[model samples]
Structure formats: structure tokens, C-alpha cells
Target chain A: MPAAATEAPTLDSLRRLTRAFRVEILRMIEAAGSGHPGGSLSAIDFLTVLYFRDYLNVDPKNPSDPNRDRFILSKGHCVPALYCVLAHKGFLPVEELRTLRKFGSRLQGHPDRRRLPLIEANTGSLGQGLSIALGLALSAKLDRAPWQVFCMTGDGEIQEGQIWEAAMAAPKFKLGNLTWIVDYNQVQQEGLTKDQMDLAPLKDKLAAFNWHTQEIDGHDLDAIDRALAAARKVTDRPKAIILRTIKGKGVSFMELQTAWHGKAPNKEQADKAVAEIEGGRR
Target chain B: MASATTGATRDAFGEKLAELGAAEPRLVVLDADLGGSTRTTAFMKKFPERRFELGIAEQNMIGAAAGLALGGKIPVATSFACFLTGRLETIRVCVAYNRTNVKLVGTHAGIGIGDDGPSQMALEDVAAMRALPGMTVLQPADRAETRQAVEWMVRHDGPVYLRLTRQNVPEIHEPGYRFEFGKLDPLWPKDPEAEPDLPSLAFAPPNGKPRRQAAILATGGVVSNALEAAKDLQSRGFLARVFNVHTLHPIDAEGVVRAARASQRLVTVEDHNLAGGLGSAVAEALAAAGQATPLVRLGLSDFAESGTTEELYAKYGLSASHIVEAALRNLA
Candidate 1:
């Protein structure tokens, strides 16, 4: 239990950390018996890089620091991934990850700010985190603070009209301090996103709404780092980084499987999933 | 009851918001593309930077309002009461649970928004806002009360719902009226006589317009009408009085108890529906307090007709004539 963050990890080590994050996410969801695994596994690399790498100006001891960079999980059902990242970063105890979605635990089924002070807002309903992020970003501008606000949206969740509403509003306010990263996992509760309701040519749609749009491989930690850094310097309009992601990213059985979206793997299945995640980095 | 001047609570809200904006730097306003109708344009025009236009996105506007409040600003989010409460889930989580200093101003309340019909009406807003824990519900009776409520709400430091009206209602209180939270303002019969002799009670002439047998509790633009109805009943030798129930939630239970004790029957009138607004609040209070006064909730029982406000009120039995008729029926 180190009080300070460890030394900056190299690309190879970051890849290892992301693999560890995926394993922990699988273990946590398996332990909880009810959790989001597909989205959590898919977004682990981006989250791992943001929190563990040389980015994200957050102090674990001072989660409520007014000037701290803000991250909102708009796809809040994937909080298992966030909980893993927070715990690994000392924002939470790693031992408590198994208590997710349990009775009388801080880790609820969805993101609850009251339950966890580090959470920016309660965002289970989807498509709402971007607007709140814009709000926090706008506040930073108003106060002349240098903090940034980042909101992660699930690909399927963008179908909500409020997402477009925020997409349209960010440019109008010229919210340079805000960045919405889309976890384009291509899988949702019902089925494949393309089959449910197509969000194809998303880059054009985001560009039309006047955002600085970028597309990248979500699993590439270096690409994520570069994209996030580049997006931060745009300072003219709000940025949207479209991270092309596989639904179940790491585990061999779970990878690219939509059925794994919300269901927890059984004990043997979880063991295999963790073994595959841990072995993949080898 | 015809006053020299009439005012829309929304119009006064805009002016007071602008006034407050000039003084309070952290006071921000968000409009969901209804700036013109919601009267947030006044504040927007004055403080463009401070007033954010969310462009027909009530959910986003509400979320942003909560965020801004979290960032140390008083954010007032405005829209048609229907649209604002339509995003009740967002409000339920971001504003109510987070306990941010976000003042949600829902104008065009009830069926009084005229031709726009039920889609634009906020008949169910009171029920929704009141359902949330730690949410303060305040509906102003007139221009004075509206301004006072807005000013007080900006400084109150919590989640509040300030319900305003689209129609022009006559000024009920004096210019210097102060807005009190969770307290009913005495508006009719000045002061009700305490415990009149029930034994010596004389019935009015059975031939003329019957007697008033209840105290009318009302809110919003209907307050003046309830007062007029009470005065009209007074002319017919009925001892009915009216109380302007501005704060619907945390409703002054003492006022309901007093009103119930003063009359044999208690009538509550609002432009809202028959269930879950002023009526439900009053009924809950009286039942909990064990007041056995017969209650009559006067509001639209079914969907409202798409007509002028006056015509709708007449049809829904929320007009002054309906109040008089109900009083007569109750007394009979």
C-alpha cells in the first residue's frame, strides 16, 4: 500500500498493467456475480493508461481537490473497470474490489458519487456524463482553472438523444476543456450495435457537430496517450476520441462476444479468463 | 378582484434573475431552447457568458446545471415545466441526490399555458418534484412573490423547484411582500373567526345563492380566483376564507389544520390534476394530523381540453363560478 504513485511505466509495462486491469475486472465481476464485463474489459486499456500512465492530474489523497482533472464514467455499468483502476491507483483498496454491487458496499451497481467521493456524478442511465463534464469544464473556464474534464461514453449508449444534445452544445460553448472518449465496443445488452441501431460514419457525425474528432485503437495504450495529449491541446472546441474497441477484449472465450456484456463468468470460467489475460502479456 | 396591473411570474423571474445576475457573479442560468418562452432570455441577454443556452436539451441542461452548481455557481435551469420534469431521472440523480445548488425553474405550469395543450402543460411537475427527497417546491402566487422567491432561492443554497406561470395573473400581494419558505400566506377573510358558536349557527335564506361551508386552499394564478370566490361567498353570508399555498411541499400543515377546523369542508383548487399535487399534499397532512374535515379537491379529473386558459379552467371546474357552485353544494 504505497502512499505515492509508482514510477512512470514504459510501454511494455503499461501493457502488462492493462492486462492486470482486465484480469482484476474479470475477477471482480465474477466475484460480484452480477456486473458488466464486456465494456469493462474493452475500456481497461484507456482507463489504465489515463490513471496509471503520466496523464490525469489526480491526487489519491485529495480526491475532492477543486483543481483536479475530472473523469466521468458515462457508461457507468462498466464501473468494475473503473473500480479496478481506482484501487490500483490507491484511490481505493484493492482488497475491496470483490465487494462491488454488494449490499452495504461503496461500490454500487452504478456510479454513485455519494457512495464514492472520487466519482464525479451518478451516471448509470447513460448519455448524461458528457453534459455534466461540459459543465465542469465550463466551470474550470469560468474560474480560470487549468483542470480538464473527461467523459467516457459507451458506443451503444450514444443512441440516447441527450448525447447528441451534448455533442451539439459542446461546440457552441467552445468547451476546449472537455473531452468525450467513446468506448466503441460495438456491443450492447440487446446485441451488436450495428444490428441494434447503426452508429456508422460516427466520425463524420462528430465532425459535423463541430468537435475535434479522432479515431484510434482503444487497446493501444501509446495511441491513447498520444490522442489524449493531442486532444488536450486543441483548446478551440470540445474533443471526441473514438476508441475502436472489442466488446470482450482480453479473455479468449469472452473476447469479441456480446453475450459477455453484463453477465458474470462462473468460477471455472473466471479462472480461465484470468489465466488467459495474465498469459496474453507473456 | 380586478387589479390595476397583471403580471406573468416568468416575466418577473427574468427581471429578478437579471438583477441577481448583476450582483451575484456565480449565478448562472441555463435554458433548453425555451429562453423566449421561459423568460430566461432576460438573464441570457444580460449575461451571455453566465447564462448558457442548452438548445432544446433539457437533460443536458439539467446535468450541466448540476455540474455548474458543483463548481461553485448558482445554476438556474429553465424550461417548460413538462420538459424539465420529463428529465426527472436526471434531476433525481444529478440534482436531488447530489444535493447541488441548482434552482430548477419550471414555467408554463398546468393547463394554463393555453393553446399548446397538455404536451406543454406541467400538471404532473408538482408530483414529480415533490416526490424527490430534499427538493424544495415553491410556486409563486403573483409577480411580487415570484421575484421574492427567485431572489430567496438563489441564496437558499440547495435543490429547489420554482414553479412559475405563463399566463398573466393579477398581483395578489403588495409590492413589498416577503417570500416565506414552507409557510402559507393568509390571503382571505383577513383573519378567520376562531371557533364560532355551532349551536347558534343560523342558515342563510334557502331561496338565494346557497352558503359557503369551506375554506378554499389554492396556489399559482388561481389564488386570486379563490380569494374572489371567498369574497363572493361572504356576500352570500358564507364564512369561507382562502389561503395562498405557495409552498406545496413541506406545506404548512398548521394552515391546513386551521383551515379544516374553521370550516366543515376543505376545498383545494389548482390548475393541476385531481391526484398528486396540492390535493395529495393537503390530504396527507390532514389525515396524518387526524383532521376529519371533509376534503374536496377541485382540479381537472380528465385530460384537459385544448382551449384558452379561461375556457379550460371553466371546463375543468377550476373557475370561480365552479368554486362558488361547489361551496353551495357542500353547504347544502
Candidate 2:
């Protein structure tokens, strides 16, 4: 039997994981000279807690093992954070992180399942991951497997009509084994999410769709851990966690800035960001 | 009034699927509340535990199918081809992109779906399925072939898109004839030695002389039409060879190139868009082989019109006469 998840992820652990993820992601993007780092940095804590402490049922060596939990990164642009977490968990060599977005690298700008294992689906086009996760969850229910499927979506990507279609579907199907985490960083490539398209009353909207809903600070590992625990307790419906986070959480100048969504940090910007993350870790 | 002999392809698909469920325990069925229309009712009845009835949600149905494949289940998802293709982008991206072993049974493919009109006819499904990487596309010639195709798909690995017709077709292939994926079956002989020269008045080439002629490449219900045209053309002193191209993607490029080289005139017929169906695939193969034969492609031009299957076939110039005319034109 798998260990029961608890509110075990600590703030200190989260801070260290976040800094490590940020530094590695910067290095990856810098090596490749391209990739979306803002969203990856913003969603680091949630991904860290999920992979290292919650949801993921995986052994890095035996990734194709059937009983392991499935994780589908629907918002594929944030692959750097996902790659960092997967490497940290030993899914691949940590050295591969520096090859991000480079030609012939397994770590492409978007996630490709053929190149990586434990990646349930290849997702790049937004708003499709949840549906894939729902499929895996439904299969688990049918097979009577003890595996769960975790899907992470972006706030800007929620604007796609397909996401709502999946949102309404999970509850209707009573897929309690499915959990969806929305990175509500309030910024898109164009501008702030609210400025682009208001998705206010987000909690009620999910509730209306029949999802068991919880809202949390995305960067707060403890809050994310608790929300996931609460979600697991529900067996009647699918769960959705609305994770509130800054677009660029740790870096001062990049925080909440739309322009940083996909831009690689230059030498000076990289130095400043690295110093801040190191300072925070200290 | 529905004729006993004139059953929909969806009905044959369902009947064959029930047999598959009994044969393979891992075989599961999923429907988007269209069990009656898509003809998965028999499978649902026999294997209720293995069946999922997704109420009017094609997107969810696709997702659930992919999920089931991940759990070691061979799921056959049934829906109208139109709804299946238009609504289930996730299925194409997730299930197909991941190369999961799932079979998508798209019923009511092409304009053979009479009276329901353009919205129901899925002329673009072949194009959509072929566009996905690592996807195998199958369009069976008739009921027996549909069953054979389903069995072949179950044993085969990776994603498969099975295009089923809503119109009944005559059984052309004899019993025990093998159905191989990605290999074109030559229904008519091109070489004299390979042709069955029976003592009792064999169907020989016209003028009692073996001559180089065009190869008629087609699939689905149109194979019979193409065969009929080939017979008529043979009577008119033309040795038209007929090839039943069951698989669309990973097409029989070698066979097509060989036929194109020998014949130097290729005519493709199908009950779908002329742009991306069998004709387009054959054209692509010919181009790759640097063999540009005079090819006359016949299929639906654009949007389909509402009518009976026969009327629509004739209206869209996809009948035996149209094929015969195209073959003649290609020869000219």
C-alpha cells in the first residue's frame, strides 16, 4: 500500500526546492537560449510538492511500471520546472537539465512523451491535459488500480473552451481519482489574466461544475500539501486546486511581469535573480 | 424501411465488436450516448462491465479511452466520425501522440450517411487520422472485412483509426483471405502467369493478348464500384487492374510504385474528399518514387449532399460509370 499523504511538505524544504528549481531552470533556458521560465518559476513550489511530497507514485528507474501514479503537465510551456522536479526525483540524470530546448534534447521547449517516461501524455497545445488525465483516472478506476492522475493547467490556458468541457466532465463522471491544479499566476503573455480576460469567482465556477474545490497560495508548499490532502479525502467527485501565485515569484524584477513569461534571463538579470534566490535560501 | 440485407456499417462494427469482447478480455467499449446509432449496443449488452456510456461528451469519451489504454485495456471508442474528429482533439494529441494502443471506431464515415447531410458525413476524418503521427488508418471493404480489420487492430500495437461506413457493401474477399495492415491486396491480376487461367473459359484480357493497362486503387464501398468499372473496361479492350488499398497511412508505396511503373496510368476512387484520402496518399507515394503517372482521382468534391447512398455516389461522381470514365480519361 502507498503511504498516506499528509501536510508534511515544510516551508524550508519548499524554499530550497524552489531556489534549486529556479537556478536549474535558468541554466537550462540559458543553455538552450530559449524557453518559458516565468511560468516555470511561478509554478515551481506546486510541482515540487506534488512530485517530491504528493500525488506522484513513481520510481525513477522503473518509470514504465503500471501501478505508479500518473502526472500530465497540461501547460507544457512550464517543462523546465517539470524536468527539474523529475530529475531531482532521479527520473533522469540531473545533467540533462542543461540541454533544455536544445536541438535533439529530450527536454524540448514542450513536453514530448516519446523522449521521456512517467510523462503520461505529450502536451503542448493548452487545455488538453486535463482531459488526458481524466482518461488515465477513468482507466485506473476501471482496472481497480490504486493509482491517481494529477494534471496542472495554466490560468491563461483556462480561457480555452475545452478546459471547461473537461471541468464539467470530471465531476459528472465522478472521477475522484483525478486532481487538477491551476497555476493562477494572474499573467499571460499579453498581460495580466484579469486584464486579458476576467476569470473571477473562480472557486464558485468550479463548484458549479461539480468539482470539489480548494484555493491556495501556489508558492506555499505547506498550503499546497494541505489542499492536496483535503482533496484526496473526497471520493465522490473530481477535485480542483486553484493555486494563486506570482508569474515570477522569487526574482524581484521579473515578478508578476508578463514580458518574463517566456523570456530567457540575460547575464545581469541572471546574476540578480540567482543572488535573490540564494539569499532567500540562506 | 430498412432492408435485412442493407445493414449499416455501424451495425456490423457493433456485431464484430461483441465477438472481439468475448475473444479478448482486455477489449472494452466506450460510447458517447450514441450506442444505438454507432452500433455498440451488442458489445454493451454482453460486456456491460467493460462498457462506458459517456453521455453526449465526445471529448470525455476520448480522454476516458486513452486512460483505459494506459491501464492495459484495449478500448474501442465509438461515435459519429464527425463528432469524434471535431470534438476530441485531446484524443488525437494525448492518446495518439502518446502512441497508446487504442482503437477509434468512427462510424458513419463519408457521404454514405444519407439524408443526415454534410454535418454527419465525415469526409475529413481520413485526413485527420492520417495527420496524426504513428496512427494506422483502416477502411474495410465490407462486413467480413470490418470484423477482420477489428481483429487485426486488437492484435496490432499502437493507435488505430477504423473508418466504418453507414452503408452495407458486398463481401468481395473470399473466406480465409488474410488481411494484413499496410499491405495492399491485389483483387485483380496484373500479370498473365499470376492470373487464374481456368480451363472453363477464364476471364482473359481483351483481344486475347496481355497488354499494359492502368491500376484502379480504391478502398471502402468504392472497391466494388471500381471492380465493376474494371470489368466493364476489360470488355472494352482495356486491362484495368484493381487493388484494394485497405490501409491509408503508411500506404503501400512499393506496390503503388510497382503498379505505377508497369501501368503508367493510375486512377484512385474513394467515397471521401479527393484532396487527402487514398488518391492524395497514392499521389504522394508516386511523387516520392519519382514516378508521375497520369492519375485521375475521383471522390466527393467538397461538402456532401443529402440523399440515399446510391444517389449520393452518383451525384458525387463516385459510381462505377464515373470510375470507368476516369480510367478511360487517364488512358487518353
Candidate 3:
């Protein structure tokens, strides 16, 4: 059985665990030969706090429990981080993380629910996860179920018009059971997100859309935990947490570097990054 | 002969869907600002709590429907065919790839939608939906067939794309008509059990002149036109058998091959683009079956102009006369 929030592990332990997960994220991506490492590293802390710290109501054994909270990685290119966290959460074997992106492996390059039934929906295509999350939240409301729906999207991914479409509908439907976390890393594949498409005043935009908005330093475990706790208290409208984060967060050489956005780290680079993440662990 | 009673397939869909909502509590409806036009207003009026008005955002609607399906609710997302399939990327990922139990209802299909013109008409929806693996594509010919297919869509698991007509299509199916998935319902001759005898493949019957025979495969609103075409062909002393092909993706291939063997030629008619709709499906079936039946595809060759349904059908070569001409063209 998973621990409740009251019996959750200390924030210090979560910090150490998340720092170690940075290595797992790199290891799998390095083994797979191609993945979006920058976004994965930027988003790992929130996923760890959500899964390991009892914010999400999923169990490894009863992953398909109807009443369990649904979490969807709408920015599915960053699934390496999700795979690592799911492994630690006992959803799958840790050894299977190495099989990610390989032919016939359950861990597809993106979140494919067909291949991994635990995934709430298939969501590699950008801007789609929020609407799907809206659907699940709507279903919960219709059934009067206690289940909640949470979706995570990259800062760059909100550029797709469908994101706004979902953003517009969730609030209109009064989907208080839903929460959307934006990993506002401010960087994308080609260049910085601002240079490509500016999402400045993102919190204001979401607030105007009627979402209960909050902005926090995404890498801080305490802030992530608190923001999620506060989001749960919101029962009249959808919650939007603009997680201001650094792309390629943990690795010094990769931080804020557009080159690390998609490329898999080489053997030397992977070793150096892993050493850096492990050294940062206190 | 076309029945005296005529009804829009969308009306049948909305009526059946609203009825299904009462019986199946798990059923939910989503509309992208086209509830009135798509006739989902009927379902929405009765089951307001169960209906979601997503407002002009088809991409979000498709994704939300997938999510609802994943959450164990049978979601029927309704929109104009052009607008609905316009968001194919979301449908490709959330619905098709995930195999979510979403019933996508695309109304206002083809030029039959009339003065709304090419923008509103779904000329490429069937092609887009058919290309996705495991996605069931259906285009019901009449009100009864639409009701039956709508019922089947809810009961069946996985994704289904139902193309419905905005214009009132003539009732071609009899009152006792039952919809069979992936099976062709022969409309002309009234009996499919008896093989349609028109002309021989090898030796002609020892009569005056061997009249050319054709098996007409038609889908959606054009089935009535094809039926009328068959009647006209009979009057002109040429025999043409018509098949109501409601199921477009997992089409009745064996039935198509059987028609190919029995008739001297095959003609497919639809209210969609000729490249990837009913024509392409029949062509693939015949090719795979190694049948040498010549086929003439009649559909929109280009984007249609704003006009009445009858004017567009007549001008765009989808009228009864056009179908009769297509069937007897090269055989003469």
C-alpha cells in the first residue's frame, strides 16, 4: 500500500530521491540514443513529488483503480523522466527503464497507453493532454467520483491552439477536480521559447481563462508539494500551476542549453552529468 | 423508387443518441458548437448534464472524448465533418493510437450540405479516418440505417467515425432493415440471396443484344441517387444492382468480389472525394480478391461550388443521371 500525505516521506528525502532520479533520466535517454533530456530534467521534480509523495492516488498494484487520480504527461517527449519515476514507484521494473524507445518495448518514445496501459492517454502530440484531462475530470464530475485528473505540459507545447481550446473549456465546465502543471522551462528544441513564441504573462493568461493560477520555482520540492496541496483546495475552477523551471536543470553543462533539449548525451557527457547530479545530492 | 418519407441522417443520429443516453448512463455527448446543425441538440436538450459544449474547438473535443472514453464513459463527439476531421492530429494520437472508445459523429458530409460550400463539406474525412488503423468508418444511407449504425457504434468497443448527411436523404431501406457491420445491404432487386443476373462475362445470352450489367456500390446520401440510377438503367434496358455500403473501412470485400463475379462492371458512388472513400475501399477489395471487374468511381473530382443540394449533385456528377451514365459509359 502507498503512504498517505500525512505519512509521506520528508522533503529532504524527496530531494535526495529526485536528484538520484536525474541520473536515471539520463541513463535511459543515453541508452535509447535519442530523447528530450532538457524537458525531462526540468519536469522530474514535479513528477517525483506527485507520484512518490502521495499527491497522486495511483498504486503500482492497482494502477487501474477507477477512483485513483489520473496523471497524464501531455508533453510526452519527456517520458524518460516519467518512466524513471514510475519504476521507483513500483509501477514497472527498474531494469525495464533501459528498454525504453527500443523496438517492441512497452516504454515507447512517447506516452502510449496502448503499449503501457497505466498511461492515462496517448499524448505525444502537443496540446492534446489537457483536453483529455478535461474529459477525465468531466467524467469524474458526472459520476460524482472522488477521482482527480492532473496533466503536465511543456511551456513550449502551449503554443498549439488546442491547448488554449482545452484551457478555455476546463474552466467553462467548472472542472475543479482537474489540475494542469506547465513546466515553464522557457526553452524549446530549436531555441529559447521566447525567441520562438513568447508565453510571457502565462499565469495572467491562465488566470484570465478562469483557472486558479499559481507560479512557483518548479525544482523546489517544498514549493511543488505546497502548490499541489493548494491546488487540491480549489473546488470551483480548474487549477493551473506555472512551474517556473530551468531547462536541463540538474546538469551544469546542459542547463538552459538548447543543444541538450533533444540530443541524447554521449558516453563521456552522460558520465559527467551523472557525476554532477550525484555530487549535488546531500 | 425513393420512399415518400425523407429524413436527414443527422436527425436520426441525434434522436437515436438521445434515446441511447436514457438507456446507457455511461453515454456522454460533446459538441464543437454545432449541436443545432449536427442535430446533437436533441441529445443535449434532454441530457444537458451529459452533454458538453466545447465551442468551436474540434481538437479539444476529440481529445476530451478520448479522455472520457478512457474514464469508462462512452463519448460521442459531434461536429461538422470538415471541422471534426480537421483536427486529425488529436484524433490520431488520443483516439486512434490509444484505441479509446470514442464515437466521432461527423455531420454535414459532402456537397450535399449545399450552399455551405466546400469549406463546410467533408470531402476528405473518410480518407483521413480510413487511413488510421483500427478506426471504424461508417456512412449510413438512410434514417433507419443511421439509427442502427449509431446503436452499433455505442455497443461496439474501440473508435468509430460515423459520417452523416445534413440534407434530408430519401429513405431507401425498408422498415425491417437491420444494419450488419462490414456487410453490404443490396438495395436494388430487394433480395441479395438471388444472384443479380445482368450480362455474362464470357458468352452473352443468345438474345438480340447483350445488355451490359453493373453492380453499383454506394454510400451515405448518394445511395438514393444510385437506387434511382438503377431504376433508370432498368428503364433503359440495362440492368444495374445497387448495394448500400454503410460500412466503409471494414467493407464487405467478399460481397464486393461476389458482385464483381456476377456483374460485368462495378461502379462506386459516394458523397466524398473519389480518392480515399468508398471508391478506394472497393478498389482495394477487388484488387486483393484478384477480380478483373472494371470499376468507375463517381464522386467529387474537385472542390464543389455553393449551390442547392440538387444543383450540386447534378453539376458535380452525383445525380441519378450521372450514375447511370457512369455505369453504361465504356460498356457501350
Q: Pick the candidate with the highest DockQ.
A: 3
| Residue A177, model 1: Cα distance from true site in angstroms | 0.7
Candidate 2: lDDT over CA atoms?
Answer: 0.82
lDDT of 2 by residue, B205-241 (tens): 5467544477899988788888889888877777778
- Each model's fnat? 0.67, 0.65, 0.89
Q: Candidate 3: where is the Cα deviation over 4 Å? A: A1-6, B192-199, B202-208
Give DockQ for candidates 1 onward, in order.
0.63, 0.63, 0.89
* Candidate 1 C-alpha lDDT tens digits along B185-233: 8777654454242422233545564444577899997888798788788
Q: Could you tell me how far off, in angstroms, the CA of residue B303 lies in candidate 1 after the best superposition? A: 2.9
Candidate 2: which stretches are off by over 4 Å?
Answer: A1-10, B1-6, B87-92, B189-212, B262-264, B330-332
Candidate rank order under DockQ: 3, 1, 2
Query: How far in Å is the alpha carbon of A88 misplaced in model 1?
Result: 1.5
Query: In candidate 3, what are the lDDT values of residues B1-332, reduced to their tens digit?
Result: 54689999999999999999999999999988889988988888899999999998899999999899989999999999999998888888888998999999999999999997888889999999999989999999889889999999999998999999999988987778789999988888776555435336533434656667789999999999999999999787777889999999888899999888888889999989988989999999999998988999998879998999999999999999999999988776
* Interface RMSD, in order shown: 1.2, 1.7, 0.7
Of candidate 2 chain B, the 10-residue stretch with the lowest lDDT total is B195-204
Q: What TM-score fits each model?
A: 0.94, 0.92, 0.97
Better of 1 and 3 by TM-score: 3
Q: What is the DockQ of candidate 1?
A: 0.63
